[model samples]
Target chain A: MKSESRKEEIIRAASILFKEKGYSAVTMRDLAKAMGIKAASLYNHIDSKQEILSTIIIELAEEFTTGMNQIVNSKVDAIKKLENIIDLHIDVTLRNSDGLASLNNDWMHLEEKNLQYFEKMRQEYEENFRAIVKNGVDREEIKPFNIEIMVFSTLSTLRTLYLWYPKQKNIDAEILKHDMISVLLKGMV
Target chain B: MKSESRKEEIIRAASILFKEKGYSAVTMRDLAKAMGIKAASLYNHIDSKQEILSTIIIELAEEFTTGMNQIVNSKVDAIKKLENIIDLHIDVTLRNSDGLASLNNDWMHLEEKNLQYFEKMRQEYEENFRAIVKNGVDREEIKPFNIEIMVFSTLSTLRTLYLWYPKQKNIDAEILKHDMISVLLKGMV
Candidate 1:
């Protein structure tokens, strides 16, 4: 792993702190103290706690948006696209579960323009997901279930992976990816 | 609907307030103001805000425990038991989604024995779910995908139904139940 910049270190520490205590509850002093640095030194690298939150959240949101965009535009079928999407989530989760936790819980605390940008990315992600499911139905690539139900069930499972995956120590990444893709796409029975 | 007892009235009003503004932020005055009753009147029915929160959450947790116990004890096969569990969540979501919001978002605020009780019920609920899935695999009634994966995927979707079900107006209960069971049990493709 490459040495992280001071800003990256601050963001990383803040993400974990935010996950534990929530965005509003975490102050910069708490963050600096966690890092064994003085509080004033933090302002040199980042402006405010909001900046840390937005950086942690927006960066992850954009990562998802980018992943979903590529998957949606790919020539693969809906099921394949979905597999890739699941892999994207697992990949992100494995690398930075703490950051994902902050993104999930602290995105709402984003201010003004950054908030709008994050929301837009999220909505587009969902819309792209919906369109893929609808396309699957139209082409008979998938079953004729309620489109919204299918979308909601699958997305909800994927979205909550950050909370579930960490507790699972016996299950490795490859097994998780393979089993998750199957259970999600092919069902349990 | 049957008439609500005065205590029930306070619990219902406080649940909505808790959902709107999280349990920590909402005050007894806020709940009383929302209910259009005097603060002293609220005290007459409910002992404290903690009482209101515990009543909403512990009651819902007990309801799930009861429903799961019946499902687990039934003579049905594992797949049938899983379907029954899905129906239980839908029934509860339909009945008191606001109370569920508190249970999901603020159950940690439940002090003392109530917190312990809620966690125990939640763990048992998950254990029973795991047992049913394992039984299904043994009986060849279900695929042997990672038991934890299957359980997590299904339960996460069901646990989050309260948040999603309220926004979906066009989909009636029948369709939601049918489609959810199908998508969760049989997969989307």
Candidate 2:
């Protein structure tokens, strides 16, 4: 991996602050104070609060988009693709849940071009997910449940893991991955 | 069911406003204007913004508490109890998704005794769910996934149903109930 840049460091700190107080509530001064840097020094590394937010949200959205593209392009079947998607969510959540929080809550605050890009990525992600489910149904490899219901049932849990997983320090990561995939895909029956 | 009182009418309108604007952002003046009543008339039905929030959240929380009590005491097995709990959530969500939005997003804004009461009810609700899942695992009726994982996997979906179910007008309620229970409990594959 490449060495983290100064701007990346500023964005990372801003993501945490955004998670805590929400994007609208957080200011550059608070983020600077949290990083123990002078407020004016922050300007050298980042442009504005909006720039920090767009960076945090857009980067994460692109990361998810890239991951989804890989999984969709892979030779895996529908169930395998779904499992990989779940793993992708877990991997991202574990690495940058604070960033994921901003991605989840503050993406709407993104400016014009960034907002459109993020929304398009999101739309494509859902469509790719839907196609996988639809393929599974067509091939009779998966249950013919309502496509929307199945998608939301799984995605909602995966999406919200950032909020839930951080507090659950006791659950081992491997165990969490194993059990969450099991509970989500295979159900608990 | 009892007839809706004027106070209840005010509370219902306030819940819709709270859902749209969040609890803190909404004001008595906005609510009164929405109701086409003078602001003083709103005072006749409710005490303050705090009271409206408490009424919306506490009443919903207590309603959940009441339903959970019935399921917990029922003579059915753990799986059946879990099914009943799912039905309970759908019932409430269907009846009042708008109110549920406030219950979910604005519960933290509840104050003093109301806050304590809402938290207590919420804690008991989770504890009861945990116990039911634990019982299912012990009886070998449910898979031995991590109890917390199973509990969250199921409850998170149910709790957020209020948000998801409203937009899917093409899906019938009965079909939703059947497919949702199947997808949640029995897996997709």
Candidate 3:
């Protein structure tokens, strides 16, 4: 394989192990073993286990950051913006469900600098999400419920879609997205 | 402390460690250290680390089981039943947010018999939740979205409330429940 594809393959293998055993429990040798390569050869593509983890997590985080930036900059109404945001989550999460377990559960185990960066990105993401909800409430487009609860309920459901979406193989993406919006934004009642 | 209170305290400390390190990473010695007790004394109240984990997880699962049974049997409409189900989640999750981590992330680590039992409880819970959603759709009380998607969306949000609820300390329980019902059952749009 080409060098770039080789690195991608290594990261893919690492994500599977990370998802199963978590970051701390997993080791470079174990990852190499899972990939059917010598440990020394593994080091040729990745600097260290930390580097592999940082790649898996930071790349995925940056994707969200980039997506959220686009959504925030759009001139759409809050409800429209929120729907686009949900679409972004479904798209990104479905594509990278493997890395999501680490994104959700193992980011804290990142080395100090990476940990800080992840935390900052997460904080900013929430602030931007809250802004959308606040705008919706202000425009009376959304109900005047507690903003925190609104954000929490909506975001939490979207955040964990990776866990549920994969099991639902037969459901079309459009159908799933429509149903999610209905249940989450339009309320089931 | 009395024996019963001591057991509770042990479970409490175990939950904190379990939440931070996960069930597989946490040890009996670590639980004792967190509780400021000896490891030998730890065994006096709990049979093993597995038992501590089982107690934390199985008890919570059983509570949901019992709560779902109550809601399923109620004479109320499907929407009311769902609201009651949501209330049960928020109440139980808030009270045991720490244990909720174990319940969500660590149940897979449970030993054979306990693991089987936990899985059984979870399967039944989902079936009953689906039944409620199906009833709603059939009665024309709920929109005819895909039943699995609706249940997945609703339960995923409620299931992960433990991750978000503790952080929002200022939100009152009644307000949380009301907003949740409005956003979930009524949709924000």
TM-score of each: 0.97, 0.97, 0.94
C-alpha-based local distance difference test score of model 2 = 0.89
Model 1 residue runs over 4 Å out of place are: A1-4, B1-4
True contacts kept of each: 0.93, 0.83, 0.88
**Candidate 2 second chain TM:** 0.96
How well is each residue in B1-189 modelled by candidate 1, as lDDT tens digits? 232587888888888889989999999889888988888877767789999899899999999999999999999999899999999999999999999999999999999799999999999999999999999999999998999999999999999999999999789999999999989999988
DockQ per candidate: 0.91, 0.86, 0.82
Please count the clashing residue pairs in each candidate, in the order shown: 0, 0, 5
Quote the lDDT for A1 in model 1: 25
Provide the RMSD of all predictions against the true structure, rounded to 1 decimal. Answer: 1.8, 1.8, 1.9
| Candidate 2 A-chain TM-score | 0.95
Lowest lDDT sum, 10 consecutive residues, model 1 chain B, at B1-10
lDDT per residue for candidate 2 within B1-189, as digits (tens), equals 233498888888988899888989998999999999899878766789998888778878889999999999999999889888888899899998999999888888888789898999999999999999999999999999899899888988998898899999799988888888888888998
Q: Native contact fraction of candidate 2?
A: 0.83
Q: Kindly report which residue stretches of model 3 are placed more than 4 angstroms away from their true locations once superposed.
A: none
Quote model 1's TM-score: 0.97
CA shift of A136, model 1, Å: 0.2
Candidate 1 per-residue lDDT, tens place, A63-119, comes to 999999999989999999989999999999998999998888888899999999999
Candidate 1 positional error at A123, Å: 0.4
